[model samples]
Target: MSAPGGNWGFRTGVNDFWGEDHGRKTIGKTILVTGGTGFIGGAALRALADSEPGTNIRVLSRQPLPESLRTGEVLHVHGDLTDPSSLRGVCEGVSTVLHLASHVGRDPELCDVVNRHGTTALLADARRHGVSRVAYMSTTAVYGHGVHRGLTETGVNPLPVSPASRSRLFAEQAVRGFGGIVLRPHLVYGVGDVWFIPTLLRLLNRVPSWIQDGAARVSVVCVDMLGEVLSGLTRIPWRGGETYHVSHPRSTSFRSIVRTVCSTLRLDLPSRSLPVAEHREISRGMMPELTDHQHELLASDHWYDSSRIWRKVRQCPGPGFSSRFARAADWYRDLLPIG
Candidate 1:
């Protein structure tokens, strides 16, 4: 969300995806969205199109978009974050920058280059172009994995573990230093998500079990709704550089997610259960990809206080995981059908 003077037109829909627009401060404003080809980015593209009519949208990408991803009236500009020179002109005429582009990989250098240095370069370009506001999509993983519950945005220190999270922590600082807003979502799941669910299935594929019933409470949000939120943030009259936890207030348990996945996707996973010690040993021996940090994420609580953001938009949290996940079930079914 933008700072106090920027009036963001936002309200929750009573019977729709995300409607009830009170006032759209972004009308006729050219909004630039980066990483518009990735999982959550895809959803944001559509959501922005639906939510804010008459707003000029510029999607920055290194490669041309495929035919299927082409949204109406979205001007695709050829740009790469890694190449700082390429970003020189992308921010021209861009009133607001929704910075969702990030690097998520094991390569520390790539992460730093894209997430930290790239963001700094982007912010510099935006400043030169007189871009008024910027919003960043950071991850709660910056706090690392532990039993975090009901944590506020300003209360905790970020002890990042992975190269990705560490780099993003620095990215957040750059965004904050520029008087921009930051949103930290724990687990985002829904259509086009090739990471969260598939990763879980990978762990289960190697060892079909849970660590002590897998009751780790995690905050989850559907991509569709998240897209809508990001669009609003571009125009919302928010507190400057104020961080918010963007998630449903209700925490969904890991065991419940597994059960839902099995039932919805008809997967015969979790056929057996294991204790924490055995699970770690087997994962270490067979599936080394399942790092200890990943295991800790699945075996503990990570929920944040997201009421502030919901209130900012004058909306209540949408449906819980069961109902919300059902909205995108068909897409997932087609993508990961395994009856």
Candidate 2:
């Protein structure tokens, strides 16, 4: 049973968790954040620190703490998810847990070991330590191979096409069994991102041919926004099986997004066209990292309905599509490293 206002207790369907005061009520709570050094995890750390200054934050990292994280009252713990013994004392006295670490490589075997088995280990340890609430970060790619318009949470059982997604789904099953909240978000982009924007920038220079004429409508969310929603989730109480989709209400078409980003970067858009099979062949030769499933993601219309999460947080609407892309273009070209 879900308690009301306890460590894991949160009111359902209430958007006032973080009011005009910016979630000041969240102060003084202890939260252990895994993957705190990664792109989305780092954003969540900053958002939590900024919103609830008094909140005690613990970050789990396998490597030494980065210089930037050492400035504040953040506690950095050295550990690896694959090594359960390394996780000692990390969950002690923590009221909440955010599991964001995952193996994002192309190997299905490794993906299961890290994403599935690793999560299983962490959840077991957290439960043992009396952690009240846990939030698992998931991907929209879980719903694989579908032309979705406004897919709702629990809308479709994930038909994961890739090993990464399959493993994530497996992890989701574990989280659900453990009574933790699951957040499934689509392509997240922001300042620290090295893949999404940089890859697109590189693609603009080569590959004369494109897929589906770049007309797929894709759903994407800003990293900071996703962080805020996640922060809110930690405080709000919910039933053990609650799941939510995270994304902006508006959907941006692939063609328009690419054209706008290219224009901002002062790069030329791919004007040439090719059949789907031929386009896949060229991408495979050039960008071997993109798997067959990824190619389909680029070519198909995939988006989600995020009204369930949106109603729970009072966030200022972001800028328009063109302006958002323009800002990201500048950041990708200058601030973010591309190679």
Among all candidates shown, the one with the greatest TM-score = 1
lDDT of 2: 0.73
- Worst 10-residue lDDT window for candidate 2 reads 1-10
Cα deviation of 222 in candidate 2 (Å)? Answer: 1.0
Span of ten consecutive residues with least summed lDDT in model 1: 1-10
Q: lDDT for every model? A: 0.77, 0.73
Going through the candidates in the order shown, the clash numbers are: 4, 3
- Candidate 1's C-alpha runs over 4 A off are 1-27, 334-339
TM-score of 1: 0.89
Instruction: Judge candidate 1 at residue 68 and give its lDDT.
Output: 64
Assess candidate 2 and give its TM-score to the true structure: 0.86
